[model samples]
Target: MPCQSSEELNVLVKEAREFTKDGKVADYIPALGRANPHDLSIAIQYPDGQCISAGDIERKMSLQSISKVISLALVLMDRGPSYVFDRVGMEPTGDPFNSIAKLETSSPAKPLNPMINAGALVVTHMIKGNSIDERFQRLLSFIRELGNDATIQYSEEVAKSEFNTAYLNRSLSYFLKQHHIIQEDVEELIDLYTRQCAIEMNCLELARIGLIFAMDGVDPDSGKQIIPVHIARICKTFMVTCGMYNASGEFAIKIGIPAKSGVSGGIMGAVPGKFGIGIFGPALDEKGNSIAGIKLLELLSKNYQLSMF
Candidate 1:
């Protein structure tokens, strides 16, 4: 009842789950390597309070890059678009999410897009808080507010694991410090960024948060605007261009919807006026996206005609 067909979703999930064998789980960060490759789930929420879902809905996964969109929305709410955009450009990079090659070539060293690690670092730095804890708590609260779910919390094990292996991210932040894009201690900001990426949520919660952005920052359950309409538009635009890392163009063309994906094999999608979708499949393809997740979405988009274009 969440959308128009829960029965159909049950069938689709079964077919999509079959594709999980084609991809591999993300294992660079040791903790992430522990996830079961066979697990897959999808959650869909509509503005009218309907919930449709299938698969392993109880599975827990980190936000990964999908947190970038949340951080961007929070920064925009606190500092507005001009201030946030001034630090990060609206452009997309064809490079990998953590690549620093663009920084060296670009004179100002502004991150190519907010969805990348470099730009997400800048956006996290702009979060309004005096201390690292305050800033992280602010972000956590904002995420919970969106989904109306206060139980959501960061996976400290995952965050610390990310911290232990964040050599490239550390280097990226140092470069930002060098360019003066970030003024705070480099370690503190990277910690915040990693923690944001480590926040854990299930498919149901992911769908709720996606629903918020899908509704232009308004939570229909609460009948309140948690984020401004214009800022949501900005975030959604970035999601389309850079949410899938270098595979964004293909995803936009094939899926034709605004979506953000995380390395945990999670993708948060907004179908404009229709519905919000959250999918999880631990297996990833070469581009760091859930191979099974993308396959499921393609089927769903075709069935529901969910393409925004």
Candidate 2:
């Protein structure tokens, strides 16, 4: 209800679009580099099933790091919190999302948190499955349920691109393997992880998934709990603490919501029992967040007093 109409949201999107010029699209992975730096989009899904949008909300993009939060939720459901937390810490790191410096120095050699590459790799490894195919299918099925879209699938081109260039992630996996944090084959884990990151969807679908989290993991349409309330709380806590990479603190202070962003310029925000927001702005700031998307969030949070704080 805070954003009453698409016309109002479009005004904010237009204003925030100006900041896209200040950012650059991520090109480390060859496929991700092809995004139009100026493109921006947003969608909001209310619990009552009403949705409002601005820009190209149907354009599909990879999930990138946003998949980490979903994977974490699935793993927690699979292995339970005690087992998952025993291997990965709950703290946030000031370092970059892929940094392994802390992994080398941590007393027990565990990653600082699940949002980082090291920790995500560990979490993915913990997903319950008998084989890589079976494991990936399980994760994929969960994603489809969250989006409420049966057609949702991973981008083979993007997945291949990421898999080929995932040297840092491979190194992190090996390090975790050496410490016995992840006992699986490095290549297998990387394959699954890259595919996980490459799962693609448009803004509206992303918004629907965010709505589930906003409603404490309940599917508003079905009245079913996809994720338990306690687990939803844990996932939202991480989104507040580490979801925006190292920029999480500033984002929390500015936007004051549980949101997760990805290098693909996708942001999924849960406004806590109100509505879910999804944004995609491929032009990334220096910290790898969607430049215009964050600006739009700032505008929305301020104009509507949407901040939970």
lDDT of 2 by residue, 119-144 (tens): 99999999999999899999999999
lDDT of 1 by residue, 1-309 (tens): 333436788788778878888889889998999888888789899888988888877688899999999999988889988888788899989999989999999978899889988998888889999899999999999998886779999999999999999999999999999899989998888788889999999888899888888999889888898989999989899988899999999998888889999999999998886778898888998889998899899999888788888
Candidate 1 residue 297 Cα shift, in angstroms, is 0.6
* TM-score, structure 2 vs. true: 0.98
Which window of 10 residues has the lowest lDDT sum in candidate 1? 1-10
| TM-score winner | 2
Please report, in order, the local distance difference test score of every candidate based on alpha carbons. Answer: 0.89, 0.94
